[model samples]
Target: MGRQGLMAGYEDLVKKILRIRPELSEEDLERKVEEKLRSSPMLSRLGALLLLADELGALEVSDGSALPFDLSGFTKVSSLVSGLNDVSLSVRVIAVSPLVRLDGRAVLRMKVGDETGKASAVAWEQKAEELATVGLSPGMVITLLHAYTRSGPDGRPEIHLGKNSSVEVVEDTGTLPGVESFFVPISKVSTAGTFDVKGTLLMLSEPMPIQTKSGTVNVVEALLADEDGEAVLVAWRDKVDLLTGTLPGTELMLTDVRFRGGRFQTTVRTCVAKVARERHELSRLMAGSKRLVSDKLLRVLDVVKQPELVTLVVSDGVWVYRLPSRSMVGVEVKEGDAVRLVKGFVSERDGRKAIMTPEFGIKVVTGEDARKAPSVDRRRRLADISEEESDIIVEGVLQTKTPLGAVETRFGKAEKISFWLRDGEATVLCSAWRSKAREIDSMPVGKRVQLRWVRVRRNVFGELEVLVEKDTKVVVLEK
Candidate 1:
């Protein structure tokens, strides 16, 4: 590489650095790079920029590469660099375009993604026919080997496959994330790109058939809205299935969709699935300034008895909610009871969102009226537990463990207990706070117990652990 080649590489490195540290202006980045090269006279400009990127924490694996899936020898879509050869990436097929003659050769274009980001890829000649033969569809995970990267028309890096390249279906991994997991909040979308979104269907238009070169295509338009904002979603061909039979207020998740010309459009690779509306709208209970009118039935998941305040871990079928109060609002509430919070003030405790009610805000619903409340299941398998979920119930045989005792926390020194809960499928570490530590201390070794309303969160070492607090209901069951 000559001076021009070296300068191009330097420019690319500068762009990569700017992408991660957008707060730094281009002139500032160039100035810093110049200063680094001057200090280390022997170091090349690119090497100096790499060191600078490391110093700024821009080159860390903190991006989507931190996902649980196997990323060995695979590059994240967001990390793709133009002018790199023999790149390997594991991504889910987002869309596949029909075979077309490009520059007198058959070409097949696709959109692929992992949890981190999405990218555009093109297959040429033999590879194009091979991909079409394989009938690649949306959601299929595959790895591209010996592919090359080039900047797209929009200046973003894209993958290209030639004669030496190969694509293999990833069959061994079950942890590959679905496209829906990357849903972008409605208010955050501001540019043209492929994105996933979860929102309630506010409006829908009748599908109309349009004649095209290939065949007749059905088109439908829908208005989607979430807590933050709303957007227009347009669907074409089979993607129109999302709009058919869908009613207003029904929550929908659109995956691998494209946003352009101030609207959203669904491609062949787009997947439309109806999301759980009850959970989607639960945020409204805690958000907004207006007082809630309709009584929201909350199923008591766990009850913690304290000296002054009783902490009730509850759920509205989807999201686990916290309620800490000195008074039960003239109602007798227990674990598994269905109650309503009237004019409750949503508050946050130790980073956890909770609701505080006054006078008569807490009311218990029973018998015939309870049937109308959302059904809440406190039972869950250890394997189903994830860091993103909370307020879980698990039944398993406990492994013997003594109380850790007197761990220092922000609050103060608190008694702590640890044990292993093992079911047929998996085993998980269960730890308890001071209020619940005594209960676990008395339990015999290998005893079967059901722990309800236990919180699921990561420990200090970044491992998922079951947290038992005063509200946790631990029932010793017969072995």
Candidate 2:
């Protein structure tokens, strides 16, 4: 080929790799292809270039005859690299993850690898159910005929099986080789894959309830560390129940854990977790751990989110206890719960108290009970709040709608609105998020508007002011 032809062919190969792994940096692509070319024999330099091009998808498969009969159009996982990104290839099933229901369809995603590299494969609808019918399991050699390829959101190479694809168990006839299994360190885990690793439990967060499309699920996080590094372990649903009795500093071997994007996590079902037999080292390490005194329980008066972290303002109503990151524990508690510092680190910055560790405990109590604790006085009439007091609750009727205004936000700007509220005694300006500003539209002017967990403080100019927090419940009572 001439110089121009060679340049065109090389550019086409680069474009092919970009199609499947678009996130692959240009420098990475150049290095991989150049290395592959160098490993080839010098006598087939020109031939190697042609093969690379055709393998990547530069040349379309010939129509009808002339091509190899039966297996003429098959491709390999390694060549699925570079050209046309998508290729019809056969691979062995390394591990099949448990079927998860999504939108009423049983979706099966699994780890499939070849001699080249590891990749993920997914099947949905009828293809998913056929996985069991074909008796697909760990170390099963399966031929995914007419399967296409795509780049996962995380840039990992993935094989996709659609309605056009078919899966059949192939005998170990030396043609298809089984992929080697290995353990991935916690540091190298970030995307979706089935992996195994062992580490010592450094920290354990309580089960946090989260709402999902399937329903509510409890998520608990455990930090595992060894001499190498630390990895995060998350257990979902009933899986968290398994770790409830497991204490910090225990040794755990997480096998076949489903690690999705964000952090190292583990799901139940197909995953197998084995804890260490003894924990003498763990017991000695926690000997000096700190514990919260029940007498110092701080009543949570309100909740506020500063950026991505939720700050719980706890008090006996006379003093404020600031717990900076209650979200880390994933605990759902509001004004009714009494937050107590537990077995974790605690510190005081300036004049305020701060719970440094994500670990803490909560005690549920009514507003009446909170008021009875020592000097706490949480509820008062709209006109009764004094300038010296803050973090109180009030109930009134929304009198007028405040004009919505825009405020600077992390992404860009956000809207906010305020209104006047009355309780037959006095009035205060109640604010709502711009997205929630229209909530008062359905609220009749005379319809009673009850505000719980509102903040009353003196603004910059030294005037008594009332502020509504994001968690502040604004319920419109009927006439």
Candidate 3:
């Protein structure tokens, strides 16, 4: 065959082989070529060029650039150069795995020093895996072989190491260069909203459960006062289990605090708590301060085992009702059973205040002696006067009702149901969401039922609507 025809035939074979196994690396393709050449010695040069093309893969090559080495050298050297990089300069030593996912493919990352400054060099996936095995430790010098530049994720140029690239690690016996370390003072570390602040533990509270996205979360919230005043630190879940019953004044450290409701709170998932004896430098910076109000004292109302909903009359003559769920479980307290709740912030529903339970220390003082508060008279009558003002109790028959099963909520899953009910006064439309919904749905619609903890809200059409939540309970009455 003529030279052009021979070359064309060899290219066709290379394309066919690549199509069969696109994932084949340079060494893999060369192995196949060696086997073919052994069978037909006359086709050795054509096999060599095809092997080189397979190794190069899709990477672009400069014009007139010769192949780095023969097939044997390409395979052996490619294995040796597990990772490769060619950058203007080297910078700080940052771990590379987090930067990219190579799936066992050779990868490399290096900071190369340049005339202007230092920059990062990144090799992705298969190319990265190949370079990784060559021991590209920090401060190691390497020579770039058949390395080329390509655009990276951030739209900037980065090194792309192919089979032709070369890398090496050499020992440096001279005095090591000083590495710069960064530090932030506690005061300067601004936690604008909720954030995690790690410092010496200045004070701690008893272990308690706080409602969170993951259901009931056991937690111990304490004051982590450093040189920059004090911050609320919460140890969640297992951390709470470990820190509970710890000494009050013992030093503690916390991580992964979340700032919410104008205070820092941590959950079982993101928080870590520990007790220590020595004060940290941040704590020293926090010295010489007057006694600030303790978080325990501020959050006292959270721990009180009250019903899911509690009503308090504020000094402004507005009644504020605090509702409990998986969210407001643990808090510290301070004052009165009937103290007025000051309006701080209102929740999504215009009526409830967003004040921390511990902030008011208020208690249920009026109904202390009554074992059974006349729910039918107080709650039901209010429901009758204005459906929007109702907090009703009912004993009625639930007719054939459509059940609303589990509903997805930001907090978690909740079940709901809609039912028609006949009380002495009138037939009403009622709906239950969450646990209560499941309970009501389980009862026979024709059976007599008693419902407690029901709240009435006006729908968009100005009709009274009963909104039943998880805390609402349904009892099947004896006919």
How far residue 173's Cα lies from its native spot in candidate 1, in Å, is 76
**Candidate 2 error regions (>4 Å):** 1-78, 81-96, 130-146, 154-156, 162-184, 187-207, 211-219, 228-402, 405-415, 418-469, 472-479
Report, for all candidates in order, the number of backbone clashes: 1, 2, 36
TM-score of each: 0.37, 0.42, 0.36
Candidate 2 lDDT tens digits, 1-479 = 23354356456555554554567776876665566556632212333444544555444543332311224345656666422333555566655655667779877777665665556677878888767454466565555655667776556556777776666554344555543343455656666676665666756665555544476777766666654555557778766765677766666655557665444566543333334535666654344334222345567666665344566767654665655564433557775576555533333422334443344444445566555644355667888866645346688877887566788877567677767888786987666664466565556677786776667767676766667654566766766
Question: Ranking under lDDT, best-scoring first?
Answer: 1, 2, 3
Candidate 3: worst-modelled 10 consecutive residues by lDDT: 293-302
Task: Give the C-alpha miss distance for residue 325 in model 3, angstroms.
Answer: 15
lDDT of 1 by residue, 104-129 (tens): 99888777788777878999999898
Give the Å shift of residue 268 in candidate 2. 14
Question: Which of 1 and 2 is the better model by lDDT?
Answer: 1
Segments of candidate 1 deviating more than 4 angstroms: 1-294, 302-311, 334-337, 366-368, 410-412
Superior by lDDT: candidate 1 or candidate 3: 1
lDDT of all predictions, in order shown?
A: 0.70, 0.58, 0.45
lDDT of 3 by residue, 216-309 (tens): 7655455555555554554566555545566534544333345553345554223233334554553463454343222211111112253332
- Model 1 clash tally, residue pairs: 1
If both were scored by lDDT, which would come out higher, candidate 2 or candidate 3? 2
